[model samples]
Target: MAPVALIACFPCRHSKRRCDKSLPTCQLCIRKGVDCCYPKRRAQKYIVLPESNGVTKDTVPTGNDSSINRAGGSNRSSEWDQQSPLEVSYATPSVIQSFGTATAIQFIAPSIFREAFLEIPRINIAIPSEVAAHTGEFDQIRDISATFFSQVVIWTPVIFRKNFFNIALNPLSPRRTEGILLSLCMKLYCTPAAQDHRDGRTALYKATKQFYCEVEAAGIMSVCILQSAILIAIYEIGHAIYPAAYLTVGACARYGIALGLDKLLVDLTGENNAGRPWMEVEEMRRVWWGILILDRFLNLTNPLRGLTTKDPEYDDYLPVDDWTFLNATAKPQDNLKISAAFNLKMGVFTRLAQATYLVNQALKFVSSLPPPSDSDTVDIGKDTAQLRRTIWALISVTKTEFDAHDLATCCQTAISYCAILLLQDCHWRRVRISSTEDAYKHMFAESECVLQNLALLAICLRKDAEEGKSLGEEFPVFLMQIVYQGALTTIEMGQGSPNEEIQERVAQYKWLLQHLQSRWRVAGIYLSILQSKEAIMASIA
Candidate 1:
């Protein structure tokens, strides 16, 4: 037979392209976006092939028979199922090496500590050469102030998170930070300048404004840091100078308004309806208002000096009535009324307490001075007597409005303050004491008072909880827990002491913790009941 030629499909042959031969649209037609044309064809009948050899009709294989044999043997086929040379085991050598390198890098470059001490940029204020050239005393003050600012940066975030989450964040750390900052600020104010008053005021204004701005921007974790910074600025300005600028009522009002603290309070408590029942919000507002009032009183310009003032600008921003908003929003119930009245009364007492504290601080500062050799030891006995009288008077004022419950609560706060003072005094005395016995006695006495106050506070808290009163209700449970912890601390401090007073103090602290724990457990149950009721209502809705 002559050699046969294969013909291409009509579309491919016409377009001068290769045909795929298996589809309605050939590869060329599909690629070009043209319709594929196919010629009509009739179905052909299959014909059987003749035997290749005549060994036997059954042994001779035809084309169709070969195809059938190949199909039947497919299950046993090896050629199609063979693995390629490129195929490798699950654990490849290259993959193992790659993973090992990654693991080694991780071990070598641990990021934990590196990230922790990362430095952040901070604002730098230039001090004049003359100002910086002050005594070593000024350097010490600067170091303390700087340390406080750094701490504020560190702690601001922590406090914000705690407050925002309504968690039991410790106030002591922030309080300590604030104290240190305040001390530093006092030192700054004391640095004598040609224009001491104006310069001191300007420095204070700048520092306080910066502190406020930093705090707002820093978020919850930086709360302690910011608080410390603020305290530092306040303290430096208030105490550094002989006549403190911050001590004046006008200065206080100006500082408060400038900081926009009133608005900040609303911003903080307004979200999530934190101050629910309206009364709670009102109470908080009153607390902040009182704080502002105290701040103003402590400033250099006394707004309350008289109705008339030299500067009209000073009185422009002052709130018309400090307690009006609070009074108007208070709940009508007798209990809330009593609570509101007590809070106001306590607010006044707190101001007196602060004054007492300030006076004591001033006395201590004065006493630290070396007595003139010819001046007969510079007797401050009269001054000390007056301070004692003032303390008693303040205590009396606090007692006047106190019920059995409120009195106990007030005692708790007052005692805590006393404990802090005593602790500080003990630390100072440790360096100067001649008799260890006397020092131990004083320490034990202070520790005992702290425990007693905590016990009294816990008892009052329990009573209030039982009566469905709101005092301390919004405060974190950790606060109560810490009160118990404080008692434990006292007990621990008194252990292994030879003095009888110390032993008694230890015993009292243990008893206080035990009683407090029992009361707290009951309070927890009440909280659980309230939570369950809320859950039930939610489910029904």
Candidate 2:
């Protein structure tokens, strides 16, 4: 008889396309939501044997039950039958190379896995010879460092400008960590200019890799290296490669824990003071804050993933004001005055950090609950009440300390507002699942809070637009996210209410979203959503 050839399943066969011949089912059938059926198989009796090439070939099992059982042929057949095309493609190679003791496939399996799962194609970026040749150029290093400090340092003040410049421009010796930081700094600084200068951004990216290799070669751990890791994470975030950014921050956190940076030092004497400079201790704290900010934002944006610092049980003090940090050797009284001068700025950063921390804590608490039951309803209620109180207190305090006109202050205010929406969304979901309430009064209140904050955001953006100030340069991506949420909230508030205030707020939000259309893609998306009167009216009704 002719050899029985493998055939496609019904779905693939009917569709007139190639099939992977997956037993029982195939990817196309699974994706198309259809039943997969194959033709009946013929019974055969054959043998299996292991070869000298570390390969195994199988034939149909013979009629001896004991022999079939001992060979475990049934289980092998079942596993093969269940295997997907991807799995089969991974395991069986068309050709294998044998070295003295090792058998190698022509292709690496992990690359195939990445291609299949992540769908991120690999692209090789050629490093220019001049970047390597100009590694020691003082002017080039200074220019790049200056660009970073001038543009990016205002938002993130972890690096001391003078000290960074001195280290990078040193002729006799240059620190590997500092070089790495400078490369990352250049990458971040060049990002905004990328639209105009793609080649420059590419060069900076290549230079960053070169510097990162140098840091790896040195294999030294210090505060500066930690700073380099943070900057690299920030660079990755700006570039919107979130998974890479997440991994970078995870590495930073682990390295930090190993170095005792996460531990709150109760004793400042003895080993702590023996040789460690005060500057180093303070810098470590600042770096910790940086890590916390990055971690919180990561979790906020991608809540489904594992968070690096879930609760941040450590008691590291918040970073001091910029002037106090810069004047490390200043007198206590002088530092106090500077702190007072920047107290509002300091409070804005600190309060936002605390709000983010509390949000994360609340999420962790909610996520830890057992699936809803009659007995758990009361406990959920109490927890929900406590969270509401905490959120309210944060909003009240932010209001009292509000800087209505400052861009950073307004940006954070928008976050505080958006958090209300997220909190209520969580609350309503659990309440409905638990069958606890038919109506939630808090939902209306939370929606109003969102509208108010969005109005405030609109005012802030309007002010900036009036002054011709561009938020495109230093605006955090999350601010655009806040704007997006605000647009939705405005629609919710204005839907059925014929109240003029509601209409006015909705119009203001629409204008703000439209104005930001040229800034970020998010703005355009929100603008389009708000522009749809039909959708808004339908949703409202």
In order, candidate lDDTs are 0.34, 0.50
lDDT score, residue 310, model 2? 38
TM-score of every candidate: 0.28, 0.59
Evaluated against the true structure, the overall lDDT of model 2 is 0.50
Report the C-alpha lDDT of model 2 over 1-541, residue by residue, as the tens digit: 3332377654464457777777657767778676655544534222232234657532322221110011112332332223211122111221111110111111234332212211111111122344434443556666656666565233345665545554455432223234435545554444542444422234565566566555434333455667777876765665544467789889888866645566522222112223344554555655666777677666654455677763654242455565666656522232122112222445344555555655666556655656665555534445556665666666665566545545333434555555666555555555552211232343646555655656776787787778988755555555666666665544544444435765676677677656644433345555666667527555545
TM-score of candidate 1 against the unseen true structure: 0.28
Per-residue CA lDDT of model 1 for 364-473, tens digit only, reads 44435453354444333333434444444444556556554554334324433342333334343333333434444444333444455555555665656567774531
| Top model number, lDDT | 2
